[model samples]
Target: MDKAQIKIYGLLENYLEYCKTNGFTDFEIWCEDNIDSANEKGLVQDIYREVNHIADKLFD
Candidate 1:
Protein backbone atom coordinates (compact mmCIF):
# COMPACT_ATOMS: atom_id res chain seq x y z
CA MET A 1 0.00 0.00 0.00
CA ASP A 2 0.97 3.61 -0.44
CA LYS A 3 2.02 5.81 2.45
CA ALA A 4 -1.44 7.31 2.76
CA GLN A 5 -3.12 3.92 2.83
CA ILE A 6 -0.60 2.69 5.39
CA LYS A 7 -1.22 5.72 7.56
CA ILE A 8 -4.96 5.20 7.36
CA TYR A 9 -4.56 1.58 8.30
CA GLY A 10 -2.47 2.56 11.28
CA LEU A 11 -5.15 4.99 12.38
CA LEU A 12 -7.78 2.31 11.98
CA GLU A 13 -5.73 -0.14 13.97
CA ASN A 14 -5.34 2.38 16.76
CA TYR A 15 -9.07 3.06 16.74
CA LEU A 16 -9.89 -0.62 16.97
CA GLU A 17 -7.49 -0.99 19.86
CA TYR A 18 -9.11 1.93 21.61
CA CYS A 19 -12.55 0.42 21.15
CA LYS A 20 -11.41 -2.94 22.44
CA THR A 21 -9.76 -1.38 25.41
CA ASN A 22 -12.95 0.53 26.17
CA GLY A 23 -15.07 -2.67 26.02
CA PHE A 24 -16.59 -2.19 22.62
CA THR A 25 -16.95 -5.67 21.22
CA ASP A 26 -18.83 -4.87 18.07
CA PHE A 27 -16.70 -3.00 15.55
CA GLU A 28 -19.46 -2.29 13.07
CA ILE A 29 -21.79 -0.94 15.69
CA TRP A 30 -19.12 1.22 17.26
CA CYS A 31 -18.09 2.58 13.89
CA GLU A 32 -21.65 3.30 12.85
CA ASP A 33 -22.27 5.20 16.03
CA ASN A 34 -19.03 7.16 16.04
CA ILE A 35 -18.54 7.94 12.36
CA ASP A 36 -19.68 11.49 12.84
CA SER A 37 -17.17 11.90 15.63
CA ALA A 38 -14.42 10.92 13.29
CA ASN A 39 -15.72 13.39 10.73
CA GLU A 40 -15.85 16.09 13.34
CA LYS A 41 -12.23 15.36 14.17
CA GLY A 42 -11.42 15.99 10.51
CA LEU A 43 -10.22 12.54 9.60
CA VAL A 44 -8.70 12.37 6.16
CA GLN A 45 -11.27 11.99 3.43
CA ASP A 46 -9.80 8.81 2.01
CA ILE A 47 -9.58 7.19 5.41
CA TYR A 48 -13.14 8.18 6.20
CA ARG A 49 -14.36 6.75 2.92
CA GLU A 50 -12.46 3.54 3.44
CA VAL A 51 -13.76 3.16 6.96
CA ASN A 52 -17.34 3.79 5.89
CA HIS A 53 -17.01 1.29 3.08
CA ILE A 54 -15.66 -1.34 5.43
CA ALA A 55 -18.40 -0.67 7.96
CA ASP A 56 -21.06 -0.98 5.27
CA LYS A 57 -19.69 -4.33 4.19
CA LEU A 58 -19.53 -5.60 7.73
CA PHE A 59 -23.02 -4.41 8.71
CA ASP A 60 -24.78 -5.10 5.44
Candidate 2:
Protein backbone atom coordinates (compact mmCIF):
# COMPACT_ATOMS: atom_id res chain seq x y z
CA MET A 1 0.00 0.00 0.00
CA ASP A 2 0.93 3.62 -0.32
CA LYS A 3 2.33 5.62 2.58
CA ALA A 4 -0.94 7.47 3.17
CA GLN A 5 -2.90 4.24 3.21
CA ILE A 6 -0.38 2.69 5.60
CA LYS A 7 -0.59 5.65 7.94
CA ILE A 8 -4.38 5.68 7.93
CA TYR A 9 -4.52 1.92 8.53
CA GLY A 10 -2.10 2.27 11.45
CA LEU A 11 -4.12 5.10 12.96
CA LEU A 12 -7.41 3.25 12.57
CA GLU A 13 -5.94 0.06 13.99
CA ASN A 14 -4.67 1.92 17.01
CA TYR A 15 -8.01 3.62 17.49
CA LEU A 16 -9.76 0.28 17.25
CA GLU A 17 -7.43 -1.22 19.84
CA TYR A 18 -7.96 1.73 22.14
CA CYS A 19 -11.71 1.46 21.87
CA LYS A 20 -11.58 -2.27 22.51
CA THR A 21 -9.43 -1.87 25.61
CA ASN A 22 -11.45 1.01 26.99
CA GLY A 23 -15.17 1.31 27.78
CA PHE A 24 -16.22 2.76 24.43
CA THR A 25 -17.93 -0.39 23.24
CA ASP A 26 -21.56 0.68 23.16
CA PHE A 27 -21.56 1.43 19.46
CA GLU A 28 -25.32 1.46 18.96
CA ILE A 29 -25.86 4.02 21.66
CA TRP A 30 -22.88 5.99 20.57
CA CYS A 31 -24.18 6.17 17.05
CA GLU A 32 -27.64 7.07 18.16
CA ASP A 33 -26.28 9.92 20.22
CA ASN A 34 -23.48 11.16 17.99
CA ILE A 35 -24.57 10.62 14.45
CA ASP A 36 -26.63 13.67 13.61
CA SER A 37 -27.36 12.84 10.00
CA ALA A 38 -29.23 9.85 8.70
CA ASN A 39 -27.11 9.84 5.53
CA GLU A 40 -23.90 9.68 7.51
CA LYS A 41 -25.30 6.93 9.70
CA GLY A 42 -26.26 4.94 6.64
CA LEU A 43 -22.77 5.34 5.21
CA VAL A 44 -21.20 4.18 8.43
CA GLN A 45 -23.53 1.19 8.54
CA ASP A 46 -22.42 0.29 5.03
CA ILE A 47 -18.85 0.40 6.22
CA TYR A 48 -19.75 -1.90 9.09
CA ARG A 49 -21.33 -4.34 6.72
CA GLU A 50 -18.33 -4.40 4.39
CA VAL A 51 -15.87 -4.79 7.24
CA ASN A 52 -17.91 -7.52 8.83
CA HIS A 53 -18.04 -9.35 5.53
CA ILE A 54 -14.27 -9.51 5.32
CA ALA A 55 -13.80 -10.17 9.02
CA ASP A 56 -16.18 -13.10 8.91
CA LYS A 57 -14.14 -14.63 6.13
CA LEU A 58 -10.70 -13.89 7.58
CA PHE A 59 -11.33 -14.74 11.24
CA ASP A 60 -13.97 -17.39 10.98
Best by TM-score: 1
Structural similarity to truth (TM-score) of each candidate: 0.41, 0.38
Q: What is candidate 2's local distance difference test score?
A: 0.47
User: What is each predicted model's overall lDDT from 0 to 1?
Assistant: 0.51, 0.47
The C-alpha RMSD in Å for every predicted model, in order, reads 7.2, 7.0
User: Candidate 2, residue 17: CA error in Å?
Assistant: 0.4
Candidate 2 residue pairs in backbone clash: none
In the range 1-60, model 1's lDDT, one tens digit per residue, is: 755455556667866666545633334434444444444334454355666465445444
Residue clash pairs of candidate 1: none
Off by over 4 Å in 1: 23-43, 46-60
What is the TM-score of candidate 1? Answer: 0.41
Who wins the lDDT comparison?
A: 1
